[model samples]
Target: MIGPRERVPQAGRRGTRMAEHTGPGRSAVVIGGGLAGMLAVTALRGHFDVVTVVERDRYPADRTFRKGVPQARHLHILLSGGQRALERLLPGTVAALTEAGARRLYLPRDLLTRTPTGWQRRFDERRHPTLSVTRPVLDAVVRERALGAAAGPATRVEVLEATEAVGLTGDARRVTGVTVRARNGDRGAASRVLPADLVVDASGRGSRTPQWYAELGREAPQEVTVDSGLAYATRMYRPTARGEAPDAGVNVPGWPECPRGAAYVPVEDGNWLLTLSGVRGHHPPTDEAEFTAFSATIGDPYVHELLARAEPVSPVHGFRDTCNRRRHYERPGGVPDGFLVLGDANCTFNPVYGQGMSVAALGAVALRDTLDAAGGPGPGVLARAQRAVGRAAEPAWIAAVGADRPYVRGGGAKAGLGERLTTWYLDRLTARAAVDRVVGAAFRDVFCLTAPPSRLMAPRVVLRTVLLPRRPGLPRPPTAVEPA
Candidate 1:
């Protein structure tokens, strides 16, 4: 248990100078120890004298799955945009991930995507490189790096494992601290309040910040959700022989016409993860035989053909909490001073888009940059940081909502002229991207988070997408990477 006086002893030199300039006695409390929580600590390290992390689960000793993160068993990719942000926050992290057996897959070049129109041409521009690694490996490496950085001379960082944050200590005007209790199943264990100058909520999708706000007599932030009733199942496989697997991973995404999709991607240890997804009535099955059969129903048969040559090494696992939810914390009076919501706690996207982890990294970069600009924790620093976080999420949110709006039952609400026009242009652009390298590079740039979505609206891209004829991609999946 971490009390006001208790401090974890560790040593490092990364954030020493930054701590020297911080105001004495300033402290911060972060609620959660996952990637977001750790990154929040990274962003807060030099800004505070003491930083404490309250986590509900005990981390595993090795790079293995833990019960706290249920979605770890599925496929996860770190987009190029996220990769750069993560490296910025913790230098050399991308290299560390690659050294830990994570495969680097260049966008379009290393991934075979079946767009709504047809198979996307594999462009070897090598502009966007994504990291494909198991969630456990990714989490473990990040945890090790963050904890190391936290041990600097200026800020003292401590993590209380098997502990949960229950409520806030302050009222609606400003957040002052957090109330936490041990998770050891001791009914008589008393709760304690850890006072702080700032508090951050990075508790992911199951966050209880709203309830905490309500307890403080403040209205919770307004939330908007667009759920496509998406559900997915995953299973692990290994090729029967070495080098038998394809050089590139497979992606067959669902379209309005065909609402079933699948992705077979390579992970660490030469293992492959095959995830199948569908909306509402077309949810994929978890049964071994049914899971294999459903693969044949996606937009293309390439993924199914690959599945036939591999041997299953794990039982099928299913997950269904895929929804696009955003809490409007940037709105006026939405959050109190000295309090912030970040990562999935503020905005969660449909997992099929593979944007969550990347967005989290980008949000951390925004937080760090905002703090540096503000110089220190001043009167309106946290609020400004929160708004910066919201801005970081906007591009991903727009992309997700646009992609998912069509799948919503009854088409949800009627779109206005601007939205309808944008949708029409995007549909045509998607078709052009499948065959046009210039348009495809622009599309990947935006989607990978390396550039703003405005890149897609550039005159060159717009003219090509709007003026050129739509050409079909390769009728079948390419057996080898095509030269640029």
Candidate 2:
């Protein structure tokens, strides 16, 4: 990794020179050194001779929080789909995470979820497995793996830390590189252009690609948003007694009728994260006393009961940027050639759904696959790759928007006949999923991104979800893994 003082060897305009000349003249630059940017670097291996990552904040030396990622203090999980994608990009990443104190929680089996109906059954189908870990740990491990993978003999990956990308270097027709400057507390540093064949905007939710495009006399990509006005507060805790810790995590999600939710899940270092959430009028409080008291008001009392036996280990942290926003970069003439957008920059889901990181990894995998299919960076390749990244985020986007549409202020627009009917069926399906194993498996498959939404419409799943009697879930959280 290159420090802020180090300069990437550059030559004159249009066609520039790489730091270490080898292979071809191809080079790529990724803006943002977060999880998405690191994975983007891994994907560019072999495809680009030299790949540079520009990051505004210097990464911490250890597994600790940094200003670059404000949500690092919150609970984060890598879903089954994301694990597979990360492993594909950099082999054994999941195992590396687990070895570094990340906990593996099987879906529905190791997680106790309370739907609108009641507490869901603990089904040991073992189809989907998720990793529960602090965001810092996750970022550290993935960053190490991705950087390590990028250090092959074929491709050279350079990380420019404490560097900021100011704008694009090319016209609206095609991006040639990025104009960046050192962010090392120097206000007078002159901006310089780093020429590249491709530029990936992985700057995340704070991306200014739209404004950059406008500066180039091009229209910004169309955007869509679905905000439920959800806000959440999180704090770390450790059980007062070793034996007092629950065997599994608890999640009591909000519904339209209640609109209050809570999740208490175990993380590394014998710590657990308890996050309390609510929409608009019922936002969770950040006060110490009120935070604990609010846990009791959620749909289920199991989390509140667990909190009573746990001692607080960290101050409460609240996050309110829960809106689901998508930039339509895949549409025709939306983005110029040689430029691509992925991760949160393209589609950002409400943090409550826990889909952001997974979607980012999936998008990187799509980028790698698209580049492989196209052979290398060329005319129309970046445009096609951007569309592929968009496709990767579709499942999570649909699920989040559908879930939040009901909570939008003023009820938004009236649903069409098909949407209304689909919503009706989904409500019943969600209720049925809590108790029925078949329905639960189907529902989880889509929720985990391991299967398409059409999985819920399978004949067997549809019959069970439609014809079966609406049975309530277990009245209490099951202490055992499987039903007796």
Candidate 3:
């Protein structure tokens, strides 16, 4: 039997090509042209006759930081799951990233992380590997691939720059379009309305989707926020001949005691993207002197050493808007029929976990499946898509909240006795992960987004955790040694 799919509307802009509209033939309007919006377009490409991406900022071709995405200046890595999804949507996308200087580095082996447990030991290559590069470069590549996939002569993909989506155009039962306002030349000016079969809000953390839905007489989605007031400071450095290794990249994990994190991701053109982050009550310094000193406190000296040697290529860019916020769009009676939310608009994660981009990519994959199930962008499409996307987002939410709660100052309700027991047992599992290959692989599966967190408590994995030694097994932080 054919899986559930959206039924196409009989009268719509892209309705003439009914055969091509196996999912939805009606027009699709996507607000925001970031990575999530682009990938969402790819997911709905064949299903829609006309796909319009509306953006507040004009997109540029070159790999440089721009407005709308202030977080673009920092070091970003695409988890293995996201890499595979992009490849599935647009073939050779990962290769393109590598060609553009993003390293497809293996985890554990290619990574050097100082965890709360201990320094993670070097291990053999696993099933999944992460892609490391500048956020702008990664976005440029994905944007190019997505535009190529969605744009065509007949089934065209249109992008409206300098346009703002202020309100929904449809009623409470079904959304028909949007009320948009383009930026004025200097001051006050009237905006225009754009109609469509479907409207997707990928407008980042600042999205007004909750208010928009309420104004449409729809119920508001339940909000869950875990904010540690995290702050990130990043600067680019020119990579050196000795440190530019194709095999490994430097990483430093955050701890509960320290609540600060750092990373040195190898990017293209012999460059390294350096980032330092601190949680609530322990903010990282943005100035050159303080930035270097902040790196010294992260329980390691490698990042500090590198910062002292590499030439600074960019000014220190700082961001404190990082928070873990989610809208419960999946719950019953939560979403409307004609509108759906994706990416940071739907949920925002702490950037230190590096889960936002990957989760957004996963949401796009779910978008493809949802469109296929619905048969097109039908009136019932919004609610169904919300549930599907929510399911796809579960893994990342669990991993991020679970690991982050311990570090954040009162980020989560105190762990119950059961939770404390579970935490203690899992600590042993993670301790084993520092040395045991099998345990490391199992843990890495969840940590790398290749598997679910449930795997950590599986029967065999739990038994391993129970059998492992009580004492932590990894080495202490590496210290400077005398020259030969």
Error of 1 at 177 (Å): 1.2
Task: State the lDDT of candidate 3 residue by residue for 235-292, as single tens digits.
Answer: 8887555744334567776666777888887777778888898887778888988888
lDDT values for all models: 0.85, 0.85, 0.75
Which stretches of candidate 3 lie above 4 Å from their native place?
Answer: 1-25, 152-154, 240-247, 410-426, 471-484
Give the alpha carbon lDDT tens digit for every residue of 6-105 in model 2: 1221111111122354567688999998999989988888888888888888777557898988878787878898888888898998998898888899
RMSD (Cα, Å) of candidate 2? 3.9
**Regarding lDDT, does 1 or 2 come out ahead?**
1
When 2 and 3 are scored with lDDT, the better candidate is 2
Put down candidate 1 lDDT per residue, 1-484, tens digits, no spaces.
1111112221211221233434577899889888899899899877888888888887765678878789999999999999999998999889989988898999798999888777888878899888999998998888778777776777877787888899998988988899998888897879999998999999999999999999998998998888889999999999989878989998888988999999999998899999999999899999999999999998888898888789999999999999989999988787898899889999999999899999998898899899989987888888888889999999998778777877877644455575566667778888898888889888888888888888989999999999998887788886666676
Ranking by lDDT: 1, 2, 3
Residue 326, model 1: Cα distance from true site in angstroms: 0.5
Top model by lDDT, which number? 1
Error of 3 at 155 (Å): 2.7
lDDT of 1: 0.85
Model 3 worst lDDT window (10 residues): 1-10
Put the candidates in TM-score order, highest first.
Answer: 1, 2, 3
